[model samples]
Target: MHRSVLPLVRQTLGKHPAMMGVASAATGFMRQMSIKPFTPANRRREFQLKDRVESLHACRTQIFKEKGVGELPTIVVGGFVPDATEQVEFQRPLFREYGSVYYLNYPRHGFSLEMFFAQLADLIEYLNARRQRPVLFGVSFGCGLIAQFLKESANDPNLKIRGVALASPVLCTADLIRPEGEKAGGVRMLESNLKRILKSAAEGSEGVERQIERARRCFQALFETGAANRALTGRHLSIRKKIMHVIETTPADGGYQRVLALQQLDGPRDGEAVFTGPTLALLAEAEDNLLVPTSPTLSLLRDPERRRHLFPRLSFWKVTSPEPDDAVAHASLIFHHHCYNPLIRSWYHKLQAPQLFAVI
Candidate 1:
């Protein structure tokens, strides 16, 4: 139910900037109520960092070492999952081949974008203390987080980021929600479909639990309907179940607050100047199930003229498969280890080469 309201609010804001103050205040109150206060106990239990200022949870995957090497390079992953234990474990084989991997988890189900950025900074500092700069790998929302971090920490001497790899990066929220012309109609259609899911669940239960149930149903319908290519339905079904589990368990208010934060994000426009490092952006050829129309970020990256100006150092790849399922193509870009792992390896090697960074 609340999911429907969020987009309406964003659409309203686009038309009338006068409501910005009221909207911001409302958003602030929601964020304050939903996000849990950070504490030392949480730090000890979740992060296992003995000397801790705040709490941050992460799943660490160590690389296999030969006898004499000092230590393998580290890869810090930023993902959308609040509890990423299983997801991180699933990527163990792929990440282990490159270096050590750490999949970070948020302290609570709901947190503001600022809080997320700060937590990522803390993780980077912790890693930098033990090692030097670590490669950053971000998927979906994680990509936006990494880009913001790069912007904020641009001039910091101690925080050197080695490289970045983004999979299905969400560069512009507006591009996804408020597309122009016919695409805008498609978004409305998708929203209408989502509302139908909520309407069907209205009779089952009442209160917060019911709302969560409806939200879960709403997402399930979106995932199912957005899946154009039936070939990937089996894999999508499995992923969708996990996603639904997260949505079901998360507090309703927190989930809504997170959505509000995403709505407010301006994406790469503000952060482009600072992101001058080796970057690999993997984009799916088909429309994302989550974002029905292709995002402006993807369009910008695809255009040679815009790409040259915005992401000069970025290596872009438009990934596609012969399979009929567009959703499968999108999912495979991230989950299909055999296809993407080698690409990551090659990029990592190129980033490490002194000559690559020496001149032009």
Candidate 2:
């Protein structure tokens, strides 16, 4: 949180951690229970994905097929803090029209970041073996992992990825977790406050609530839903609640270790400017909160001359809100697929076309 708002949260939620946890738990429970998760059921293709080197870092995957989308499936590595239950929502609009997508639920109990990345590499190879090269779509931290995966496989003559899409990319954990000095501003309260909330997840129940509430508070501040927040309270509550639910349930160590794991990957060496094959960076219009141009990921993606030299095929595009009033947010990458899907669909088609530079 910005140093300015910390005192307010202290005054309102109080000094005691339990009081803080209990306060948000009640409302979170009500809201959480109110919106039931979309069950995969018949649409789901469930299976356990084991790591190559026999590690306990395997993650479960569910492939949902939209009837008649064909056998070519896209691998979607979603960002942190989402209710693992709502796996189906990630498919809407994006795959609804015509596609198959598989979602990975990161090991919730305990796992290391290196292990998980290795596990993701295993999953990609596993899927690639069975079918055609799978397209990759990622949001937030998931995007960071995708970038790492590409860097890891950069030397391979035959990488099987069909295409890649990244939204609200969080390429560095060190920058996000640390407090921002006014002299070196860019870290938003939403991103900084996450360090503390995510840490709470490692503590268990009370920790979980602390994680949920602080995350909610961060979003409230991000969207400016409350008087305390200096930003605009966006008009999209339905979307806001869904984003909150993501924070409430994502895989932590006890579950929280995921944060530390990501920190482990400071991201592809700034010097290793090796850009993968066909890539698309989906950016948000507004910055300073969650994503800023100066941030590592955004900066890398935004530089045209640099990308032209290194990541020649990498293209950049911005997504607008689904609703006129609801602005595009950090979490909206998966949540607001309507705006994103068209661009992605277009990008994929362009990647396969004879001329990659075909206009959208």
Candidate 3:
């Protein structure tokens, strides 16, 4: 019976043109895989990029393998991105010591558990077949995937994972998803507007259609402004907001709420539950768009009891500077330009070195 749902789901997903774009915009969801044109300069650039990282297209996954020492500590880094494009060139040098660096891409315009788990299963199988144990490091939603892996492989002894690390983990409670009263910033305002729009669509839109369009336009403006200001990256945050608000407003009538259901699950609290191996977490300072201060998901990790109990081995480096005016610091919320600054890169390598990657 479950096998019968796949085709209908795909059909429904493809039915709406806007849904396709929404999906793509959500995950940098470009589906076409085009080879760059063969110009000498382009070839040279590709070669240079290839030298830094090897790209592999295999069975619903695009893996970017970085140059590693070949015989050092084995490790693999993966995430929810359709393509780990932004992280491709970042901190390449650090990966050199690892036996390999693999960034697994999500399925086109999607981050589905079945697809993600299958790909991960393949990776783990490939690694298990090898002579060494692989160190797995996941960031953000990647951390959630790691949790799944841990749950699935708890009894399997051959899969040697050195540790797990999550940067600004997503953990949340129920009530926070839908809050009453005034929204604080552009992000919340946009979310509020989008929620209203989706509700109008789900219910029969009579005169409500015009109001919905107006709200949609307002939300679009917020997205554009955020993107222009560099607060949001293209359309990622806006799509995220859309999805969050949709689920939040969805009727509690049981079937499977999926995303929101996951949001309600309990995760190992910060410093509360020590993982099987070494653990590291880069607690972002409030300003990082990757982890907003008000996110209910992050509150799970902030609890003192949870921190003390679960993350005893967890090493945390504030992803921000202690002072707001320190423009050079990585976590300065007001001035996020620091995220890409070279000094911040150094901080990442430094923190990553002592915690996740042992000196080889």
Top candidate (lDDT): 2
Q: What is the lDDT, from 0 to 100, of the residue 303 in candidate 1?
A: 77
Q: Between candidates 2 and 3, which one is better according to TM-score? A: 2
Worst 10 residues of 3 by lDDT: 33-42
- The local distance difference test score of each candidate is 0.52, 0.56, 0.44
TM-score of 2: 0.65
RMSD of each: 15.6, 10.8, 15.3
Please list all clashing residue pairs in model 2, or write none if there are none.
Answer: 81-246, 81-247, 82-246, 224-233, 252-255, 252-256, 253-256
**Could you give candidate 2's per-residue lDDT for residues 1-360 as a string of tens digits?**
598986576566555656565655564464344333222322211224243334453343323333325444566677664532232353444443434556555655554555555445655566566655666777777777777767766766444777777777777775365534433554567565566666665686687656755665565454344223322111123334555555555543324555655776656344456465677788775534565434666565567665555456777887777567666666564445567767777876665564334334
Give the worst 10-residue stretch by lDDT in candidate 1.
Answer: 59-68
lDDT (C-alpha) at residue 178 in model 3: 44
- Give every collision pair in model 1: 229-325
Q: Residue 269 deviation, candidate 3, in Å?
A: 5.9
Total clashes, candidate 1? 1
Candidates ranked by lDDT: 2, 1, 3
Model 3: runs farther than 4 Å from truth? 1-59, 70-82, 172-274, 287-297, 303-305, 321-360
Q: Across residues 242-350, which tens digit of lDDT does each residue of candidate 1 receive?
A: 5556656766545444445555566755235537777788776654545555566766666776765666688887666545443234434324554556666677677
lDDT of 2 at 64: 30
Runs of candidate 2 with Cα error greater than 4 angstroms are 1-68, 83-93, 96-98, 156-159, 174-180, 183-187, 195-213, 216-246, 249-255, 268-271, 321-326, 334-336, 352-360
Candidate 3 on 1-360: residue-level lDDT in tens? 396885565456557757755654654433122111111111222233333322212113344444456433323343322133333333334545455555654433223344345455555556656654455555455566666557655776656665565554543322123454534443444344434544554565452454444544553453344345332332344344543343333232211222323443354544434365666665556423333336544565556556545555555555654456432221121233345334334533444465445545
Off by over 4 Å in 1: 1-90, 179-185, 188-214, 221-244, 292-294, 322-328, 331-335, 355-360
